[model samples]
Target: MRKPRRPDVTTLELVGGAEALELELHSYDERWASSYLEHRRRISDTPMAGKIEIQHIGSTSVPGLAAKPIIDIVVTVDDITAEEDYLDALVDAGYELRVREPRHRLVRTPARDVHVHLFEHDDPAVDDYILLRDHLRSDAEDRSLYENTKRRLLSKRWDDMNDYADAKTDVIAAIKARARAARGR
Candidate 1:
């Protein structure tokens, strides 16, 4: 007998559409951070728990960073389709899958107003994000370094938010390398 086929987990695609990501600036606010946790709290109550590990990531999670003020949540799961068991729950909570990065096992929020980054545990992207987040939170000097870079970049006019994101890649990659060395990862 032949083995059963499974849904491919390595075909995740990026969120690329005409949809412009609003990369604006906002003063730090605890309320915004709290909302992220609050949203997770509600998510905990959803049926998605069996397949999802939700997280609050991105600049919004980093305190004192001038950001677009959107909450970035990382929902870790073994499989996005497996979470169909909780699809209704996510919808009830007002989250729609936007980006589909098949190669990376990720799905972003359909609406960027609140960035929901979905990923699987085995995915390197999840670990990379957590490592960077922890590295930034624990080291004030590094945080300042990142903030300075961001400020410098934000000062310039951009064609769109995508351009802004691409520009940060170089600095972020360098910082992540340092972060890995510091943590011995």
Candidate 2:
């Protein structure tokens, strides 16, 4: 018998169809922080006690970074493959599971505004996200470059949200490499 191939976790497929494909970028909003805090608090209050680390990540977390109004959050779980451990509690807390995979799980609020990424403890993507965010926040030149690149890409009609996100990979990678090098990692 042949073994089943494991699916790739890094590549995200297009979701939500054409109507959801509309990517709207907004000027930096002060409320983003509060929104994150609220979600964090809500999640923490759940039964998952001591099993999760919730963080406000992505473009929305960076002050002065223009981004889609959606709040992107990263929730580090004890195990990614064990969704049943916390999925029920999270759903009860108001997050609906959207994407379920071997490496991660994505959940969103009722309005589909806040995105929650669930990864296992010590996942490299967590560090990558934090590094990029911290780098962009502290380094003005790179921040400007990223913002400008995003602004330029925003005008193009993308087939889906994944396409829009994938389009920014090169710039993100370049910045991430510089960030990693600066840290001597």
Candidate 3:
């Protein structure tokens, strides 16, 4: 099976201009989960409620993991390419559309404290997000490794958030490899 890949930054169409990228990492906070729940409720209140699948993914979803303090949500819709199905409702709920790319769409709070990623229900990226989150939640070693890697990467300056994300690709791939192996897949 082919590994899911993030679209190159150049290929992404930014809905608004590029968002400011902050490299700060905060210690895990319990409030992050609540924040996700709040946002999830907001999304649920939208017309897209029953038609989509939502999961809290990324570092913030894992207890004890240091993260950037942003709640990352992965939402699987019936068709990611059909933005009209969900995008307008999300924007009306106050999330600014920040990115559009093949198989992916991103909306974030104006404060940039929460991000909702939309993908097709069958997208491998959705599974990858959940797998990595579950692995980090269950495995201390990989969690620490990922946290350390993030801390180390913070020392460098990145022109774009995607650049910072790209820097972590190798570590993430390695961890996901272990996760898949442990799952006997």
Cα lDDT tens digits, model 3, 1-185, are 22333322336697766545667899999999999999999998888733798899999999999999889999888766567779899999999988888778899999889999998788899999999999999999999999999999988877788888989999999999999999999
- Single out the weakest 10-residue window by summed lDDT for candidate 3: 1-10
Better of 1 and 3 by lDDT: 3
What's the best-to-worst order under lDDT? Answer: 3, 2, 1
Model 1, CA-based lDDT: 0.69
Tell me, by lDDT, which candidate is best: 3
lDDT score, candidate 3, position 159? 71
Worst 10 residues of 2 by lDDT: 1-10
The C-alpha stretches of model 2 lying farther than 4 A from their native spots are 1-19
What ranges in model 3 sit over 4 Å off? 1-10
Candidate 3 achieves a global lDDT of 0.88
Across 48-133, the per-residue lDDT of candidate 1 in tens digits comes to: 65556777887778877666777888877665445465556677777765555552333334555576666556678888888888
Worst 10-residue lDDT window for candidate 1 reads 1-10
lDDT of 2: 0.82
lDDT to native, each model: 0.69, 0.82, 0.88
Clashing pairs in 1: 11-102, 11-103, 12-101, 12-102, 12-103, 13-100, 13-101, 13-102
Residue 109 in model 3: lDDT = 96
Please give the TM-score that candidate 3 achieves against the real structure.
0.91
The alpha-carbon lDDT assigned to residue 7 of candidate 3 equals: 29
Candidate 1 ranges with C-alpha deviation above 4 Å: 1-16, 81-83, 86-88, 103-111, 157-160
